[model samples]
Structures are given as structure tokens and as C-alpha cells.
Target: MRLIVKIMLLFPVLLYSQSNFEKAEKLFSQEKYALAKPIFENVIKENPNHLKALEYLGDIEGMNKSWDSAMFYYGKLKQLNPKEANYYYKYGGCLGMKAKDCNKFKALGMISDIKSSFEKAIQLNPNHIEARWALIELYLQLPGIVGGSERKAQKYANELLKISPVDGYLAKGHIAEYFERYKDAEKNYTKAIAIGGSKTTYQKLADLYKNKMNQPQRAKLVLETYQDKTKS
Candidate 1:
């Protein structure tokens, strides 16, 4: 009799927890993160090991640019599921954001961990396009004394060619621009634009023409075309 009463009492609590989780998930899917966050927190309180709730909370914090808070949640997820590539990727991204706001000395200290996390993510998922892109940018931006190498950037760009030709050309154009090879950059950027008429590619070409080649007319033309396309 007492056991039956306890079961009846517990059933409503379980139903409430499931209903709350479903509501939180629906809100999260709609990107209503501000509304979803507290519900997820409540779900976590009810079931502390709720993986999806924890993951969504991390994603919500990340979307809000709360890097430290995002890292805390993602770090917990990574500890709980070390083999998940996306967890490491998110953790690396949060670390990168934190580094960006820190002093040079602190940022330098974080660089290795950031690199390792991304690398581990790639190792776990070889076709992770975003991870490859992150590594390419990291290599291109870093100084030689650290881990920056154009050659490494190029290698990743070549790998990107296998995954996405448009991204590969853009990466090559960026590398060429870094080397002050304006003509090569122009050629590659043009090729990228031809392959995929992305607004970003057009913007890059316009910037190159205006800043690097000193061709305001060409830049203006590109921008005008971009505006027309966007309006259409």
C-alpha cells in the first residue's frame, strides 16, 4: 500500500521532468536560448547526468558569448565523453575566445591547448570541415616563432580542396594576400567567386582591389554587384 502510493507520487514527477525537457529542447531548436536556458538548468537539477541538457546549456552559453561559462559546460561534457569530436571542438572554440580577450602572455599559454583540442577533434573526425578551417586560420595567423607556418596553412588549404573547392581557393587567396602576391590573390579570389558567388568572397575581392591593388573603380563595381544580388 505504501509502495503503491510512493510509485503514484513519483509518476507525476517523472512526467513533469519529461515535459520540461521536451519544452526546453523545442525552444533550443528554435534558437530561443534565453528562454530555454533556465528550463534546461531545471532539467539538469532533476537529472544531473542529462547529457542533452548539459550539451544544450553549453551551446546556449556559447551562442551568448559567455566563453568561460561555455567552457565550464563543454569541459564537463568532454570529461564525460572524451571521444566526442564536437565537444572538443566547442571547448577549443571557447578557449580561443577566452584567449582573444586575454593578455599576450596568457593567450600564448592557451595556444598549445587550443591547438591540441582542435587536433584531437580532427583526429576523432577526419572530415570535420570547420576544424580544418580553424587549423588553417591558426597556422596562417601565428608567428613562425610560435606555430604559424604558411606551408602548414597551404597544406591545410590543399586538404580543404578535397573537401570544398570554394573554401580551398579562398584559403589560397588569403595566403597569397599575406605574402603580398596581389595578382595571385586576385586570381584565386576570382576563381572562388566564379565557383561560388558568396557575399564574403565578393567582399574579399572588393577589399583586395580597393586596398591592395588601389583600384577603387573595380572595388565599387564589385560592391554594386553584391548589393544588387543581395537585394534581389
Candidate 2:
């Protein structure tokens, strides 16, 4: 009889938590993060292992650019669900953002952890496109003295091609630009434009024309075209 009474008492609390979570989720969906955060915090307070609340908190913190707080929530999520690729990816991304603003020594110390997190995310889910892209950029931007490798970047670009041709071309274009292969960069960027010309691709092309090719006239034309396209 006592156990039955305890079960009855617990049911209402569970229902209340579910209701609050649903309300918080609705707020979050509407991008009312400031309002939703406290509700999620309340839910987490009531149920420390509320996975959805934890994930949402991490996302909210990340969107707000509170990297350390985002990392804390994502790190908790990672501990709770280590097998989730998204958790590791977000965690690594938060770490990367934090490293960018930190001191050089601290940033250097974070490099291996950032790399491993992204690599682990990919290992867990090979089709994780964002993780692959992050890995590619990490390889491209880092010096060869560290773990950076143009060959690795190329390899990942090829992999991205298998997943998304447009992204692959963009990655190749970026790598080419990085190495001052202006002609190759222009070619790849052009290919990306031909495939699916986004505003970003147009901007990239315009920047290349202005900065690399010394063709301000062509860059201005490109920008004018972009404005025309976007306005319509």
C-alpha cells in the first residue's frame, strides 16, 4: 500500500516535468532562448539527467557565444551519451571557439583535444558531414609542424565530394587559395558557382577577383550581380 502511494505521488511530478519540458522546447523552437533557458534550468534542477534539457542548454549557450558554459553542458551531455556524434562535434566546436580567444599557450594545449574530439565524432559516424568539414579546416589552417597536412585536407575534401560535391569544391577552392594557387582557386570556385551558386560562393568569387586577381572591375561586377540576384 505504501509503495502504491509512493508511485501515485511520483506520477504527478513526472507529468509536471514533461509539461515544463514541452513548454521550454516550444519557446526554444521560437528562438525565445532567454525565456526558455530558465525553464530548462528548472527542469535540469528537478531531473539532473534530463537529456533534452541538457542538449538544449548547450545549444542555447553556444548560440549566445558563451563557449565555456556551452562546453560545460556539452561535456555533461558527452559524459551521459558518449556514443553520440553530435555531442562530440558540438563539444569540439565549443573548444575550438574557446581556444581561438584564449592565450597562445592554452590554445596550443587544446589543439590535440579538439582534433581528437572531431576525429572521434567521425569515427563514431563516418557520414558526419560537419565533423568532416571541421577536420578538413583544422588540417588546412594548422601549420605542418603541428598535425596540419594539406594531403589530409585533400583527402577529406575528396571524402566531402562523395557526400556533397558543392562542399568538396568549396573546400578545394579554399585550400587552393590558402596555397596562393589563384588560378586553381578561381577554377574550383567557378565550378562551385556552376553547381549551385549561393550568395557565399558569389562573395568568395568576388573577393578572389578583387584581392588575388587584381580585378576590382570584375569584383564590382560580381557584387552587382549578387545584389541583383538577391534583391529579386
Candidate 3:
């Protein structure tokens, strides 16, 4: 997700493409996402090789949660510039969405595709932290019989810890949730929340405590916190 955000920020690079690009950038800066989209599309049609436009197109799709479209643009941008970490990272994101949307019968194939995309991204750039996180998330969500392993999750958690120790706690919390270790999950999540937390983190903790852990009071507290943040 951070990779997606980085790509989104890079979209402003197109502001250097003569005056039209600047116009689009102004619209974007003004939070006119829909208004800015067409101009960016026009830029792409004018110069398909425009890296910024392609990257931004992917970002726009990502912003809208159009996973399929995001994947398409990211794939094109990756071909044009295979070395950039974010392109590969966003591509992995697209695959992750596909995995989530796939039916149970198709889940295995989707997971394979998602894993492949992330592996490629990491291969191209090992420093792509989001790509690694994507892989870890998939690993935790997927089943063990098919390449998903608690062992691998722990490995990635360790790798992530090397980068940000606090975020490592969040990652481990996710792993605990996956393995059905509810108490451990809550503990890890509480640690993560004690640091700066996001809605995703809050929701996970709430769900685990509410449904899985049968600790409704704790869930309500976290949900209250989430609602407060959303309101403010």
C-alpha cells in the first residue's frame, strides 16, 4: 500500500510535461481526482511511453480500488521500466486483489499468481519493502498445504522487523491472527496500536476480539477508537 502511495505521489512528475500536465496536477492537488483523470488519460494517449502518465494511471486505478485496471496499467509501466520497485510492488497488489476476489475453487490459482507477482517484484528489487509485506500478507491468508507457511510468515516478519521494529509487531500480529492464536494476536495487535495505528489494524484487532476471541468488550473499545478516528 505504501508502494501504491509512492506511485501516486510520483504522478505529479507529469506536471513537467508542458502546460497540460500542469493543469492536471493543479486539479489533482485540489483533490479533484475525477477531474484530473481524463487529462492524465489524454497524456497517456499522446505518449504511451510517458512513464509518469502510465505510473499515474496505475495510481488512479489503485486510488479507485479498480484492481483489474490497476494491474493493466502497472503491467504496461513495468514493461517500460522493469527496475523500479513500486511498479512491481503495485503489480503485486493487483494480484493480491485478484486472489481476494477469486472463488474458493480458483483461490489456489489466484494465490499462485499473487505469489509469482510478489516474487518477481522482490527479485527485481529486494529493497521493495511493500512487496515483501504483500508477500507476507498473502502467506498469512493463504493455506499451508499450498506454499503458505507460518514459518515463511515468521521469516518475512523477521525481515520486516529489521526495517521497522514496531511495524514488525504489526506483521507478527497478522501472523497470529492467521494461525488462530487469538490471545497472542490480541497482544500483538495491542502493541501495534500502542504505536501509531491505522483503520486496517484496528479492524483486524476488533474482528479477532469480537468474533474469534469472544471478547466483545475489547472489540467495542477498538471499534470506538476506529469510529473516532474516522469521524475526526
Give each model's whole-structure lDDT. 0.91, 0.92, 0.79
Predicted candidate 1 versus true structure: per-residue lDDT over 48-162, tens digit per residue: 8777889999999988889999999999998888898999998998999889889988999999999998989989988777887888888877889988998998988888788
lDDT of 3 by residue, 1-232 (tens): 9999998886775554546666877888787879888988888766679888777778778888898899999999888988877787788787777667778777677776677777787788765677778878777776777877778878878887777665677788878877788789888888777775777778878988888988999889998988888898
State the lDDT of candidate 2 residue by residue for 1-232, as single tens digits: 9999999999999999999999999999999999999999999988999999999999999999999999999999989989999999999999998988899788889999999999899889988889988988888877788878999999988888888888888889989998999999999888888887798888898999999989999999988987898789
> How many clashing residue pairs appear in each of the predictions shown?
0, 0, 0
- Tell me which of candidates 2 and 3 scores higher on lDDT: 2
* Displacement of the residue 54 alpha carbon in candidate 1, Å: 2.0
Q: Candidate 2 overall Cα lDDT vs. reference? A: 0.92
Alpha-carbon deviation at 165 in model 1, angstroms: 1.0
Question: Model 3, 169: alpha-carbon shift in Å?
Answer: 0.6
Minimum summed lDDT over a 10-residue window in model 3 is located at 13-22
Q: Per-prediction TM-score, please?
A: 0.83, 0.87, 0.73
Give the lDDT of residue 90 in candidate 2.
Answer: 95
